[model samples]
Target: MARASDVFTEGDADLKVLEVKSWLKSRGVRDFEPVSLFADQLTKDTVAAIEKLADTCTANKSSSAIKKAIVKGIPRQAVLKPSHAVYRLQNQRFALGDRVTMVQDSGGVPLSVKGVVIGLNTKSIDVVWDVPFMSGVTIGDRCSEYRGSTVEFDSCLNLTNPQFVASTNPKAPATSIPNTPFKPRSGPYPAVRPAPGHIGASGFRPAPARFVVSSLDLINSVL
Candidate 1:
């Protein structure tokens, strides 16, 4: 997952604070407070402003909008981080409501931590950690470290590989073609013969004699 700041600062383009506010408003985020900074601020300040706006969007469950703002605001071509949440979801092959066990410890999150995927973005995968955060220690909202690399877990259990099984619904019986012995035709199917004096199966017919003309006879007639 790309850091929110990294995502905002991609393409090496700069943005005015006012422009950032405008983008937030367009993303249905109207509650962010604009920083009273210079119209021409440093790259870091601009990224900070965008990250703050992203935090507000995350709070409002509009995390995906942050990337949209970045796309539209950046004048130069911006590349989505390879480890972005969308790609990570595909590579990891785990999904919302899946039961997963952490194989290795990450950050302060212990081994065997389990959680359900609640939200995901370019930043991180938001999970409702099975073990809740404690007092005097802030887990900072059960999110994985950048690109969800830290929080990914085994989707399957350790004991055995999964096996395919038939459905047990009696109402929907299993159906298959019968195994009766039969021989296929050795040649192409016989063409249907057209009725006597009728058009052939291809529906092709020569022009009538009255409409036919020979080039030499026509030239002689014209002469």
Candidate 2:
């Protein structure tokens, strides 16, 4: 029995074509060796088929699949609306610190976020959360008594507005009155008093006695 060497190995089983050819060429054995597995002669067709199969089997093996390049650009109508609520809430009727659950609807699902009534408005109770978008609605829940297990503060005015400080005891300081226009016109004014015992200076006139008048008449007669 002719045992199967690598040069004449098997039928339908592929061999390292280069190894066999190189070994044969090195040994100068150009003539074919006898087949052992199926007793078929090594022909050009079989060799060519083997080479073609080897070429097909050799391919790129990659760890990841090749991805196509995508071109990206911003759309013309893209806009960022206000996504989160921006007000803190408190209820005037509720005590200062009471826990209230936030609700998606007026009485809908009680949200996970809780709210301490930080503030309240006539319409809505404000809340804050690590979250921003509420059910993807641009206008959030504006109903009274937010339902949630978590809470947040939104408006700066709620905590800092004058309404929060309405109970302040300090009254507004009184406005100082501006100085008068004349500002107390004062200095030494003229004194208009007459002599202490004298009557009216314009009404005084001296009267002559009757004897003085007669003596004046006799002197004139003697003359």
Candidate 3:
């Protein structure tokens, strides 16, 4: 079984696949082993093609060359559909309808303005601020009629943002109950009452009983 540290992210999967295959080949047992032996394989052919494409781009370094590389690199299963892509910053992830707040002031929007995520892509998230004033809709534009703003992942923090300490809420003031009288109980039961009998080996009795009668009791008493 693999530990959490042994796991690889999407960016590292291709390279790890290549390394695993190379190691297997070095051991001289390639004919029986299929590519499916490793999970998350982009396939050896796909890795080779990507390497070729990268080399071509590095050599040419022109707009036309880059465009040609992208054209050749398109996935074989490509289809037109509404993208449900998720974006990440640090350990926090952004998706549609996730609540977020601005950490820095930009354009007309002020810091700590709460907003809902309406859109997201690889680089940034589009938030619709709850404020009445217009906010910037793009990266560097002044202001737009839109209620929210577009900000880079680093510019805003999400509800579960990992950058700050988890114990504190930035919006709320810290409070303490000064000089509290409450304390934890020592034990589950109340203090034990003294037993009705005498103490061990001690000849002491608590007291002798004494009685006094009132006049009314005397009048009703038998002679």
Candidate 4:
């Protein structure tokens, strides 16, 4: 907030008064006006004198800029900080997306009110917090060690513990020997042999094999 007298003293710094007023109008300075004392001082310098006067007026209007800025609230994202992080809770179990508290000063304190994990590595995890101001957090303030804690989420309600596996026999060979060739040999059947002849009361041949025939000489003599 350079005063009229203050601006005139720094002649090279402050340009002129009327020009300053116009600059203010362009910037939407509603009630801007040039101080008469400043205008009279710049009247002595006729070469670009009005421009100098405007610059002086513009310099004095810094207070107005401050006032306008005060009317606007702080930016939402500007306040909430986000950054990479490394943390471990009890037993050194590291996992991505594990929420954490950022410490007030990374070197001094270990935990802040709120933070969350967004990345993971073999031994380190990346975290992001709603508050950008918490970027000062360091490994010292955090818990390199903590209690044995487990996640209480409901998404894995039906999950079970690791189980032992047992392997089964593999598939048989694609080609194999025929079953008939491998079977043991048994003796031949007895049906091919004929049965002994049955005897009748007259000791003659049975009717199934009976036949009648005589020699030619016997037939001729009989005739």
Tens digit of lDDT per residue, candidate 2, span 77-114? Answer: 22112222232123222322233434233233234433
* Candidate 4 C-alpha lDDT tens digits along 65-165: 67433424443322323222211111223233344554223332234433333323333333333332322332222211221112211111111211111
Ranking by lDDT: 3, 1, 2, 4
Question: What are the lDDT scores of the predictions, listed in order?
Answer: 0.39, 0.34, 0.49, 0.33
Candidate 4 lowest-lDDT run of ten: 154-163
Indicate the residue-level lDDT of 19 in model 4.
69
- TM-score for each of the candidates: 0.24, 0.16, 0.30, 0.19
RMSD (Å) of each candidate, 1 decimal: 24.4, 51.7, 27.8, 46.4
Arranged by TM-score with the best first, the candidates are 3, 1, 4, 2
Report the lDDT tens digits of candidate 3 across residue range 10-63. Answer: 557758877878998998877542532211122334333433544464566666
Give the least accurate 10-residue stretch of model 1, judged by summed lDDT.
Answer: 156-165
Better of 2 and 3 by TM-score: 3
lDDT of 3 at 187: 32
Task: Name model 1 segments beyond 4 Å from true.
Answer: 1-90, 122-124, 134-223
List candidate 3 stretches off by more than 4 Å.
Answer: 1-91, 137-144, 160-163, 168-223
Candidate 1 residue lDDT tens string, 1-223: 5544564665433454457768888998775433223211123333334335545544676556656433243321122232342222232433334444444432544445544443333323334444433321222322323312224322221212112122344354443322332221122323366678887756557987686679998999999
Higher lDDT: candidate 1 or 2? 1
Clashes of each: 1, 26, 0, 17
